[model samples]
Target: MPEFDDLRDEPFEPEVLSSEIAFAGAVWDVRDDRVRYGDGEIRRQYVAHTGAVAILALDADGRVLLIQQYRHPIRHRDWELPAGLLDVAGEEPVEAARRELAEEADLVAAHWEPLVSSWTTPGGNDEAIHVFLATGISTAPAAHAREDEEADIRVEWVPLDAAVRAVLDGRMRNGILSIGVLAAAQRLRDRG
Candidate 1:
């Protein structure tokens, strides 16, 4: 094991001079903030989001669950993991992941492990997604009705190796899905 001091995290917190809502939308809010950086304060505009959760659902055969959904911003359909927003008041991130898995894929996972977490767009958005590796999966009693984008999504199970290759080949455009798949692959390899 490495030394404790070497593994310690250095805390660095910046001071926010001021912040205000530049625009408010139904899904997200745009905020303009002035913060102290280095020796001066700079103003930046970014999206304030409620965060999200994603699940990399796997079966006994090791295939991974992927969803094909239409993203209006990109004007195309892209493959992604089962995901949902943390908009429900007082709901935990993991609970959101479970809810998304049931809602989008109609599956329930008996084993769930934290895989990875990342900021979807750190430079422009404060949206962070926490992804989990869910195995020992089975069909749920009743899948929840989807709304909006989720209403038209198609779910499928793909081989882990093939999914990883798709992510490396730029076919998998969703950042959360890519990161989660890669991390899950690495963890699987390490276990073997």
Candidate 2:
């Protein structure tokens, strides 16, 4: 049997980092996650949520599509698959996945398969990034993005072996996107 990471009920100890959204004037609370590990002391943890999406797009020729975007937080451009946060209050996780797909790729997938769900930075944020397999895509104009955002996202098709090679070669930067793409590619190869 394949082994999976097991989580158990633990404790939370928090220290407030921020109490406001500085730009939007919305009240927001940010805290540090502390878990009991050794000798019942506190260990810093990542707080994650179930509201993020990682879309794996496979085109008509079975080529995997990837995006290159400038992430200011990291100070440079990184090659990654399409992904975004599912921040809408009343929408399901998959709903955010579809919306992100349309906005980022400007394409709609006729078929979608939920592949994997994971946390991006477990030592800080508790964000769960739901990865999906998207096929049978058609292109259109982008639907949405942040007003001040200028994501010069380059969409290009990469062969399966080449994509995986890039990941192994340290070219793929996003952790979750790398795992999502490799997993989806493996499944596709198995099916073929």
TM-score of candidate 1 to 2 decimals: 0.92
**Using TM-score as the measure, which candidate wins?**
1
Q: What are the per-residue Cα lDDT tens digits for candidate 2 across 1-192?
A: 866577554666455433332233232234443444545646343333445888888888878878777888898777787887777888887778788888887778888989888767765666778899989888855555644333567778887678888888887767976897789877977989
Q: Which stretches of candidate 1 lie over 4 Å from their true place?
A: 1-11
List candidate 2 stretches off by more than 4 Å.
Answer: 1-29, 33-50, 141-151
lDDT of 1 by residue, 1-192 (tens): 556766743667689999999999998999999999999998999999999999999889989999999999999889999998999999988899998898888899998888999888888998989999999999999978888887898888999999999999997878888998999999999999
- Give Cα distance to truth, residue 94, candidate 2, Å: 1.7
Number of colliding residue pairs in each model: 0, 12
Each prediction's RMSD to truth = 2.4, 4.7
C-alpha lDDT score of every prediction, in listed order: 0.91, 0.73
